[model samples]
Target: MIVKRITNVFFRYALRVITLLFAVSVIGFTLVSLSPVDPVQQYVLSVGSVSPEQRAELEDYWGLNDPPVERFENCLSAILHGDFGTSLLYRRPVIDVIREKFANTFALMLCAWVFSGVIGFILGCVMGANRDRAADKILKRICLLLCSVPTFWLGLLLLLLFSVWLGWFPIGFSSPIGVMNSDVTIWQQIHHLILPALTLSLLSFANVALHTRQKLIDVLESDYVLFAKARGESKRQIMKRHGYRNIIMPALTLQFASFAELFGGSVLAENVFSYPGLGSAVSAAGLNSDVPLLLGITLFSALFVFTGNMIANLLYGAIDPQIKESYANE
Candidate 1:
């Protein structure tokens, strides 16, 4: 029975993912198809001058002369086989370009997630533990204000203060320009990472702190929690064993969502700092009407979101037996 239940759960999520991907692919392809910019023509224009014969050859090679439906089908088939097609802009395989850039983006995102989730989680726990106090209220209000601030503006502000004005960290990209010396240690690498990571983390901190505070308040105020308090349990003990445990799943959900958001949100920060991440590549692709690269990036983002949720849900089930039992019952 347990095996059947797990299988059912897996099947359900699998079907949903397949359907979601299919729909996203169709919508993405349809939008690209409807656009006035022609990849073949764009390529020809970029080459300065191309004869009619060459233009026809390029169109045929890209399947540009094929019907929209046929082209889409071919794209889908190629994707299923791990071929994202040649990037019209870079004249390279989309997979190769994406793979190289993904490492940088992944590193940036991982750093951002740690900065946001760890710092925000700790700050939120303090706020929640001190709920209704002046300090808690003040922090909450401050977070609310920060939440309203635009992300791009915050990134630029960080760049101005830290990079331009203070001259502390390097202004752009993950690495140095020419060569690595004694000054270019891992510590130096982190120095470059800090500004962009912090810029995004500040915004994530607002949301994390708010979500955490609410979850902790609910957990702390629960009847069981009150009973423990009345039984002369220490605040730390009660919080460690009960309050924190209850809040962990919800907090995990929040962090997972933020993890996905970190990737999507990094686009602005990357472009601002000239970070060689997926977001920067994506923005350039869109501007140049590089449909293949744009589509590839979109698919990567979508997959990341789905993967994050899947991992979160799995952890949720492990943390909460009730959720597992509910799934089994279903």
Candidate 2:
């Protein structure tokens, strides 16, 4: 029975992951295909010295003369083989360029996730325990106010306050713009990261705190909680031994899902801070009509979000046994 349940859960999400990937890929390909901008023309203009014959050859090399369906088929085949094609803009493989940029984005997102999650979950537990009191009311009001503000606006405000006004952080990427400083120390790297990470963390904190507090509040008032209290457990003991277990699964699911959504939408925060992450690269690709790089980033970002959702689903099922049974019928 345990094996059957596990198999069912795994199969359900496996199918979901496959379906989502297929849908994302098809949508990305279709949109890029329909764009009136010509990638070959963009490439020719950037390269600056090609005869008409060379231009025709370049188009033929990219399978531009082939039927649309055929071109898509070839692209699909290359993508399946882990070749995301070569970038005309950067003169490198799209996969290689994206890998470098994605690492930067991943590091930025990781720091933001950790900072927000730990602080938010702690505050949530406190607020849940002290419902309707001054602290809870103030925190709730603050969360609501922050949530009303746009992410980009908040990011810019933080940047101005910290970097421009106080001069606490450098205003841009790790090194100077377009210059790589291989000798940048660990401390310098962390210094460069602080403002942008904080900006993103602030944007993320409210959701996790709000959802966790609500879930914890419900758990605190349940029959088992009351029974535990009746059986001589202190409020602290009841919460530690019973309440948290019941609440954490849902709260955790919310956190992971939010983390996924935030990573995908963090372009604005990264861009506003002049952070040399994938966000800037993606923007450049769009403006230049760099098809390969643009498509690579799109697919990579979709995969990251999908993977996060997968982790949330799996973890929720693992911690809350009822989740599998509940989802089984669905």
lDDT of 1 by residue, 121-147 (tens): 887899999999998999999899889
Cα TM-score per model: 0.91, 0.89
Q: lDDT of each structure? A: 0.86, 0.82
Q: Return the lDDT, model 1, position 256.
A: 88
Model 2 compared with the native: what TM-score?
0.89
Off by over 4 Å in 1: 1-10, 51-57, 180-185, 326-330
**How many clashing pairs per prediction, in order?**
0, 0
The positional error of residue 275 in candidate 2, measured at the CA in angstroms, is 1.1
